[model samples]
Target: MNLFTKYLHSVTLSLSKGIQKIACLLLLSIPLFTQAEDGYKLWLRYDKITDKAQQSYYAPRLKTVYADLSDPSVKVAADELQLAVKSLLGFTPVVKAAGTGSQGLTLTIDPKTEGINEEGFSVSTTPKGIHIKARSGAGVLYGVFNLLKNIQTGADPNVTSSPEIQRRLLNHWDNHNGTIERGYAGMSLWKWYELPERIDPRYIDYARANASIGINGTVLNNVNASARFLTHEYLGKVKALADAFRPYGIRVYLSVNFAAPRILGKLKDADPLNPEVQKWWADKTKEIYDLIPDFGGYLVKANSEGEPGPMDYGRTHADGANMLAAAVKPYNGIIMWRAFVYAPDPKGDRFKAAYEEFKPFDGKFADNVILQVKNGPIDFMPREPVSPLFSAMEKTPVSLEFQVTQEYLGWATHWVYLAPMFEEVLKTDTHVKGSGSTLSGILKGDTFGYKMTAMAGVANTGSDRNWTGHPMTQANWYTLGRLAWDTRLTSESIADEWIRQTLTRNNAAVETIRKSMMKTREIYVNYTSPFGLHHVMGEGHHFGPEPWLDKAARPDWTAVYYHRVDSTGIGFNRTATGSNALAQYPGGLVEVYQDEATCPEPFLLWFHHVRWDRPMKSGLSFWNDFVKHFYEGARQVQDLQAEWQSVKAQVPPEIFNNVEARLQTQYKEAVWWRDACVLYFQTHSKMPVPAPYKAPERTLEEVKKLVDIYHIR
Candidate 1:
């Protein structure tokens, strides 16, 4: 009741409130000190929005989520929405059972939605709230991710999406020992030593990222498969991964060693026609299905690079594929038979081998068998015409196999946006059926009628903190997934969307990054292997430059076998006078490619062996033009450095610095490629270094030594 007592009570309460406010501020500041952009989040960074108006708009609309948890995928969709809303809008959304007339986002499986495929979804803004509807749980997961993506990029949510191909998968060339075959991004993501029990949280994130872009399947092992993956022990490990990925709708597939019956089962011979061998595979398939019921099936790389196959037993590819297809067919599974076969003949053209082998058996493969052909006739070269097999196999359902690992694109050091390269191959006119017979059209079953369709990318992911070794290479993985979902997406638009979600959202920064990415692949090709000049990479590792490699296990594996450079001219002669590889294509393209004058300049060298002094359409001599590309490619990388430097202030310091360091490495490597290729090739051409470009400071011997130091054969 006294004035002094009342004043003391008021002071005590005021001090307590002030102390509580200070403690809360300290707790909030802890994240600022602890959190840093390390690229581990990838493009799904759901950090709180800094933009006040956008945050306000999203916060209220995403206050609640109505989803049916009975379906595991719908529960996953709900969980993702809650996490994203909490991170992006600073509050977790209350989740309710589906069919509730609540003013919140709705996740429902509406099979009646028109034009929506089994794995496709539609998102629309309703009067009550945003509605995401799909025919399946897989589609609901995809729709939820797309809805979140729209919120981040300020995109319209009223959209429907269906994958262009039925099977969009990532082929991981991971060995049982955790090493990736051509992987530059650290070690493999699968910790084989610890799997089957201790599942890495990264596996879940991996599935989430793939699901966001609509990748429905994954081949977990390398094409040069170890028979161990099929063993009961490894199947448990694979089942663990499959379980982690199942909620995201990603089914796990295996690349089986064809000699598993002999190697793993201790059979006398792994003959496809043998009853014992067939029964062995059937038992294995049943065992696998028992462990993982949704197993996607088998991806076989048989009779290539000394791998065992039906050919080993005097049988055909169809026999090998059909034998395995029969086992999986009982479970409605399919087989992806790789068409990357090459003969060991010293004098044969590697380009003609696949067509020669598979063309005859085009219609002989089992109905469940799909021929997985590389984008180019040769391996995943920097530039080559679309594979003849795409047009050659009319009766077989062919799937386009693309390598997103950047084995030839300077590994992880150099920046090369592969969307343009993928778009280029997909858009190439195959001329099989008509003018509009594109490679994409064929894979979509538009050009060739097929019961199934698929497109696969060799994954570039690894255990690195960034997932991909180089930050920019992550975009390639993103691009492959996006293009697989819808081949019609432009490379530019995909780059824009990725930049906004992953990097700085500033319009200027996005434009600069986009422009840099657009020119990245061309610059890489120019420096490494310009104008359809394929292979020529270091022998075993396929890194750096080795245009003069003449010695290898097989002649076809040698760089000299491909470039065929001599004192008089350069390039392979694939026309009628040479290997006659041009005949493999349709008549319309064959006529154009047979003659050097009519051939597209990019592919001129691929089809013709032009004289050193041949005049080019650029008004420069062939040798001079070739030299110009190498020099200009290196120069463009310098420009990329300058462009990146200008945007340093706009991007996060961690990401900006990471990319800036790589750009520096890229420039040095570009110069190394330019100097090495030009100096070595000049020996055969006997041409002077053209004007406006200085001769390389290092001699050919010095560059050779550099290759030795890098341990590149």
Candidate 2:
């Protein structure tokens, strides 16, 4: 075996022995779990260069990488390489002088120095043995992450990669108080006050994680932002974060409260057209740039959900976006204007809301402005059809914003792997530019051929010592990064990589988890929200079932609005009889959705109301199939729990215990979901429960009471 392999085996053996000794006395009653460090370490699990076999890896080649270190980004990349190499490869890589005389595994940045494309990287091992080149320091850092990934995945470290897109960012729905808006992973990791001064050591590891995954930017707060982040006091703190992230090639952006010019500054009104307001914003932007020269620009949630906007000031959405775009123009920054607006009226189609608000000003946005559209029109629900906005505005640059945090997909408690969901959306044909015009193709600027492009994910990271709360949930983050870099990659490939890196390189173990993960999203959909029955969660906190809830201020916020379950049957009538939102898509897709027969079965409930006795493609009556789905879903969870059991011997006891504990919860929740959903829907179907599926243990009132107790937390 290679030295790295031998070193890892030795360390693992000693570690396992230590654990065995600790648990020896208690062995009869309990199995000790694996070390907590296994999870906190994430996928960057590197080992020492023990045996002489892998000398070529460490030796003189990685001994010293010569970098001029002229640029801050360059210096950051070099320092990160040194740290990762030491911790993982068991050798501290030294940095020598840049350019002219550097030798062996040399990382070269600076266009004038190497002339590589701004987003491209090259790593070649020749007779002389090592040369790593990138267009910029950011590119070099990406290269380092790629190299670390190879070591972790057991791939040849000698390779080259060039990012297809210019920017890959993570959007945090984190508020000033540390509560992630829809976060299930504890509170936000960013302790705003302690920043710049206190510098939580977690910041470095956070940087390391993002750098390894090629995520180059972060918007620190929620789109529904608080004005406090704009003040001079907070800017200092933000600057400290910027400094910390510099080396990792991750730029920091602030989600601006649209009223900042008036609230933070003394402007009379934050009007996009007002001269003083414009000047106020420009000055603030300049100040932000001064502190963080690479400040990535503003992400705005204006005129949406009560957030102040250009509309409040008697201007259009484009006027609002373009105003900020103008402010950051001098600094080469861009604006991410959100297209998630709606007036919250039940009468209007919420599906058509974003398109209506954004379409009129499609070509009006400044070149630097990008409309950040969610994967679907509504909040991230399971199995949503691709957003209609993809084809609505052909002119503006659009960045696909997805949620990796599982806001609607059972949060951190349920084991729902989401790579399949991502792959499904990425491969969706928008038909914007014609046949095969995938969302990925469109966002890359090739479909409409625009310049700036990006893909963002609402971050799942928090203060959890495990990074993501559940051990397996880390796969979601891993999938997002890989897909952002290359939209065409399958969820299986990404999960496989994460499996090998985070858990084990043992092919059997990897294959088992990979199979489980690949089927996770589908299994979740089958049990919880089959056929697109969404927003059924108990109101606030979105925990458990509450399809009976309909008295909320807005219909969109109520469960009944989305599912439309009533005595006659279930599902919303989004066809021509209902919202007719299908008209928003291009001709071909509109036709498919308009006709009940052609509409995909997965979305059958989303578009049409059907009778309980209706026949389905699955060769069962609708009620039989529906009842079976609930039972099948619960069984899948139970089966998964069983599957997780068989592999206990293959994993560290700590990790095994952590996941096993979650699977227990998952099993209970799955039953809760199945029982409650089938019981309630059976009342609407006016049909008896399937022969195999027994009636729920309790009444609807009891289920509602349970929901109340569940969400009250």
Candidate 3:
């Protein structure tokens, strides 16, 4: 029997036990449903569908489930769905182990008996109820999850819905030491210590959640990869995790340590141009694929932040990417070469670095290589202008990399919803291929008709009881997958969908949460670092504001470097007089961003620094407008807080309490941010408070003292 057969057998056995457990408890009460439970199952609540019409319509028609019940996990999916339906809808279907036997709800294998692909699944409505079809049992599992999702979304599950994107992936920046960089939840999910010896049940649920979101790929290790994972020992451990994810349409990827030839193979130089180095990589690539045939290839972060790469050999990014591309080409895998590289060796404007580097190598990449660029230039800042590189690289197949983890956006402390921020960047016109140019259009390859496109979210998940530390933060992960599948999706639409599913089905509660979520990012930008004021956070941890310091080794490392706050004015000067960074644009984007009058108010401070007395195009002086925005942004959060309070009764107190507590945190931090920023800048601007606005309660020295106190100074 193949892998699917074994999985099906395991599922059959698990079902028999669950059914037996239910039979014995037939006289007992409804699911001794515990008050406290680990949120390992994610949003697949599997709650009993209490609606009589839904139960009646779905229960009987979903009677006899069918799939090529060969795989144990596929069988588990079949059994689990059957069990959930039986328990919730009060009806259980007699499942056909295999084949489309003249029956109700046939989730049959497409070819009936043959090899099946990992990531494809199709669901159709049978006259009975549903027919989940796929080439592989894992695909069947994906179909089951899709079917369940429709039911949860209040949509009729007895319909067809397929994914628009071929690849939906999660790039886990997890380290080998099990430390996830910028991870807010807890420890890494891959317990490398217990891995090859023991498999955790949470692994199944991890795959299940991704499958639900149509996510089909995961890069296992951190991009700052360690050489140990490339060894045979770790490959075995990876194989086990790969085995678990394989059943849910997810193919495992690794962040390959670039210096492997030198570190692992004892080579003198790890140059991409060297034949000996090339041979070693090809052999290593073959070794990895041999261990896990369905591996999804590599993610490299070379020549950035001190990581070694083809740049060391004096070659371009194409040389590095194509070298790896050549290594994995035989296996039909692709290389995701990150476009995050910058000469951190200088204090020069880091915002201008990516565009300077990658624009030179526009059409130099291999067909299978996708250059993954961040949504913004300087990490994931709160109010950053959409990355100029998004519009600059016309000939490259680019995948916009977005951070789902709240690394800089309040880490796990603040409730900052991110869909609106994503919408702003995706919808931004780069003008790379003329006026209608957008980040989405660039990714779709219409500008130059590139080979491929992808969007990856740095996963926020960890070993926390609630997947993300903040309960409502799951919306970030959900929003990413939704948008990746359809870039045209509106932030409000994604927020509403997530609110309905994650928070409540109640329209009032949904609307209230949606309203808060849509404005959450902007509100955050307003009170925290409004109007293109980027990188104002404390160094390394980036938890709080610290724009005054300038002691960092590199200019880019200091928030003061990006903000360029001076007695004259504030904000980085990327125009002709300063960095002349505007020349990077292909067309009139330079014109659009050059003058503060034409620049969008949100990004005005990002591109150009003006004096406190300089009148804004809005007719208000710079100082007056800046303070007004901070105050206005704070008031919006207050508005959101009041809106949430009104619909408190619609949601469960357990969930509501979690969010209410966070909003309280958000409100407090908003005040802290507003006070700290306005007070600090006022010292430089020497401006009085704009009339009708409140002055700071504490001094700038006071805020700095609080930060110093937190650092245990």
In terms of TM-score, which candidate is strongest?
1
Model 1: per-residue Cα lDDT over 549-589, one tens digit each: 89899898888898889999889999989999999999877
What is the TM-score of each predicted model, taking all chains together? Answer: 0.95, 0.91, 0.89
lDDT of 2 at 350: 81
Shift in Å, residue 556, candidate 3: 0.7
Query: What shift in Å separates residue 369 of candidate 3 from its native position after superposition?
Result: 1.8
Cα lDDT tens digits for candidate 3, 1-713: 55654554555555677775764455243344456433444576666676677776777667777655677657767776876667556677787766665546776555453333444566666556567767666566666876776765567564344444556789998887888998989999889999888899888878777777778889998999898999989999999999887777689999987889999999998889999999999999999899889898999999988888888989888898999999999998899998887776454777788888888888888888888889888898886767777776667778889999998898887888888888888888777767888778777666667767688999999888778888878888888877776788898877766665555677777777787777778787887787788888887778777777677756677777778787778888888888877777766678889987688777877889877777776799888988988888778877877887888877666767776787787777777778888888888888888889979878888988867777722
Better of 1 and 3 by lDDT: 1
Q: What number of clashing residue pairs does each candidate have, in the order they appear?
A: 0, 7, 10
Clashing pairs in 2: 33-653, 33-654, 34-653, 34-654, 67-98, 68-98, 76-247
- The global Cα lDDT (0 to 1) of model 2 is 0.81
lDDT of 3: 0.78
The window of 10 residues in a row where model 1 has the poorest summed lDDT is: 26-35
The weakest ten consecutive residues by lDDT in model 2 span 25-34
Residues 185-242, candidate 2, lDDT per residue (tens digit)? 7899999868778889888888888877878899999998999999999999999999
lDDT of 1: 0.90
